[model samples]
Target: MEENATDGLPLAGVTVVELCHSVAGPYAGSILADLGADVIKVEAPGTGDYARDWGPPFAHGTSTLFHVLNHNKRGLALDLRDRVTCERLLGFILDHADVVLQNMRPGAIDKLGLGAAALRARKPALITCDLGAYGRSGPLKDRPGYDPLMQAHGGIMSVTGIEGGEPVRVGVSIVDQGAGMWAAMGILAALNKRHVTGQGSHVSTSLFETAIAWMSPHIGGYLSGGAMRRPLGSGVTEIVPHQAFPTSDGYIMVAAGNDNLFRALCGAIGHDFAADARFATNSNRVENRRTLIPLLEDIFRVHASAEWQSRLDAAGVPAAPIENVAQVLASPQTAALGILQQAPDLDLTLAGLPLEFDGVRPRYRHSAPALGQHNDLLSEPIAPEKAAS
Candidate 1:
């Protein structure tokens, strides 16, 4: 198949070498690849990225997680522990790469002699991104990191789930993906700098730091202002009428961010009690949430979710029926937005990038490669004279 014209893709000429495993590092590489970077993912010699095994819902017996995070990239396996092979691989990447991404435990890359200092020495303009569980300088720098553990440690668990239930990890690998996005942003920023100064610098982020940054609003509220947040279970703690309420057919989420919207919500539902002097203000509504919510639920329960949605929309108040993943995927809005696409000749579908440029969006140009699928590319003979040169 012909490569589509990449007229609007931002990183068309960039090349990235991803020596990483699992979601975080590879995810960043995938984003860059989506934006038109040539991302070559270096995997382990045999087992490959560990995410390859993290699935029950596999496509062609490959991990869905791996496929989702690794599209539009090539894979080459190398035995980084083998000094000669490692050196050769590094040499190849240093010769042409613009970015190097790795998620090894703190000292692993250094041990393999591909540390940032060494790579920088070889190619001064090559950006190096090091992602880890805890960053490079802290006491826990050497410790291995994973998303779930970081969620627990970074207080994400504290703000999730029902108030009386067990502290719950997010249903997704949010910490890992957050770290990936942060790392990507840093890499792009460094790239911008490199364009001006012709120098590359180390970019580092950790799962813990990512989670903490994601939780900053709640953390700041609790730590600096003495405002504690409780797990309200699908509800915003300080916002009344922002929780999922039962409708005749199903649950519907409603948000009333201000007085007019609250009034519109009350008017739309024909609930005069919502406008009572006792519940007139947002603060009062929040204070009396136990009373207001049940009343709203009672009113909402009299109508189907669809009816409530129409009524709320007509009132210019924001509302929607609560939807599961299947429902969300099947939503007309999702289809209209072209949020999902299928890979050619593959039984898999994946999300497209959220933004468009010059009326063009990123397309999935290739399926995720199988383990060591591009071994020839890595293992091809380089004559000794070429190697010496």
Candidate 2:
């Protein structure tokens, strides 16, 4: 077995057994693994993770997306449906794993007798996370859900697209990824609690709940009798001059967050907008957006995006060019952040965790494993203490 290169990472000694597929669960496991958890990803023997085939953009015979989500984890091909295999897994978890993370189909884990309550009953130091679609107890609990379904049912799509246009899904799988983040956070909290109490915990989260949390600002307003927020294209409902405006060459997003910023923006653009009563304050500009935006739009179109960005930066007003994926990837800012990383033994560059410790990002120690690559562990010698415990 290849040794883990995680000596200095926070989770170096933690062990995670991940029985999951697709984005949300795998993403959570990836986060833990990146932070130096010894994550063993157990998949059904033959087909493995469904995400393996989720693309025409394949690399190493699997989807690039799958590789991106599954790196830094060992792979085990064990069919839980097999009686002996299931028992073997249970034994492994009770003996070795500190955490078990899963987003299997609803009711599947309990059906297999591998539910959090079941496992934690045997091993008081074990943590388990259930990343569900709807929730643990709800009408839609048993129904399978994907990212788009949650996005639509959870009301994100209703406020996502252009104003006066049919609602559109956000380009990214925000709900799945957010739910995964929540699951990771809950597990981390449980781990902390375990350290203090010598008892493990069951952490539960769902895509539906994550969606609601993301919609807090909107929901708060609507619950307080504010009208339903309509989509504002690249603009926001509360802030005028906070959207992308067309430039002579492309688009630049201008954000005049306060009256002072608005004044600076006006000065930078050579417009006396601050002197105009209808646009002097943020509230005034918001109230008069219909009039103010069109006038500003005409002025913005006279300059290229680069020219406006320079002016806004010089004036200390917040602004950015509307960059696409390729543009952002090629940017100096992106390079400076060191967020994109290449795996040590693969010809792949992927986005790393969006955080660092002591100014050092976690290393991409290895590529994602091939299916069942570490299945020999079923026969490998278990540490005597681990086995006895």
Candidate 3:
């Protein structure tokens, strides 16, 4: 596809300054960059974003995880602890940026004189987003939070493992990602509000809040019913025959939600299992799930997953073969849907944005930046003494 000036992306001409590091904050900046914003990432002087060292999956000796989250942004290293250099860069960013994003510890930015209140006072229309492990003020506000810690404290670990097994944290950093997404939404909302009111706003999101919000439904259910949720592994609590069933070769996921689908599933498998009084309805199936699951498992185990998938698809039953990351990447559906793209410069392939707008598609303009790669562009033309210290 031909690349236009803003690569046909939606957030064209927007400029964002990101004073953030690691997964949560940088991921938000990457999203803005994906939508065609000019994102400039500010890093510390010597060693940059902490994620740089977080890897065994390194690409060209750099952290692949860091590369993925920081794509399509420019990087500048500055000594923010130095008052002169800090003031110069702050002034420059405040002058040109539409949005400023930070993920520092509470009071850190304000101590540096670059807090939202200070910045907004200088540029009334500049939006600022502050992301943290917890909110700025609270009883536990000073406690440091990371993804795994949040998972444990947020109740996700309580319902993630095998039945009767020790609680397990999710394999991915879901809390960080959730917080990043919420921050992005807030930044966009604040920008829209600025359009009408001609003033900026402070947007704040925390990992603690994100994890709690994610646990609301489970917590609500527990509060209302006085029932403790046990880990069911891949099985859902309220649904029967909805989990992965092993086949001769691999596995397939089948969900028979209603009576019609349940009957159809049984018919498609050449069995009338649904006609049994114990499995005649959704409620019955849920109650006798142990019996129904074993029966379906036995039936499915007779064929390979692909064979069952084709047969079920032909019968208009909703079924899909379980796929790993490699299989998903190789699937024709993935290519046709344009879920992955190659970044020639970085010599890597990445998953693109999960959105489409009015038939317009986003483009990958550049690979993730090298540490402090844009320092020259960001350097202020100040006196030698000012630039020196």
lDDT of each: 0.83, 0.88, 0.82
- Model 2, 1-389: lDDT tens digits are 24547778888889999999999999999999899888889999888999999998998788999998998888889989999999988988888899999999898999999999899889989999999999999789898888999999999988888877886999989999999899899989999999999999999999999999989999998999988988888888788889999999999898899999998898898989889998988889988989999999999999898899999999999998877899899999999999999876768899988889999999787778888887776777543112100
Residues 281-382 of candidate 1 have per-residue lDDT tens digits of: 888988888888877778889988888888999999998777789989999999998869787647789998787777767887777887776666656642
Q: Per-residue lDDT for 21 in model 1?
A: 93
> What is the descending lDDT order?
2, 1, 3
Q: Which candidate tops lDDT?
A: 2
Q: Which regions in candidate 2 have their CA more than 4 angstroms from the true location? A: 1-4, 382-389
Q: Considering only N, C-alpha and C atoms within 3 Å, which residue pairs clash in candidate 2? A: none
Clashing pairs in 3: none
Ranking 1 against 2 by lDDT, winner: 2
TM-score of each: 0.93, 0.96, 0.91
Model 1 global lDDT (CA atoms, 0 to 1) = 0.83
Q: lDDT score of model 2?
A: 0.88
Worst 10 residues of 1 by lDDT: 380-389
List where candidate 3 sits over 4 angstroms from the true fold: 1-4, 379-389
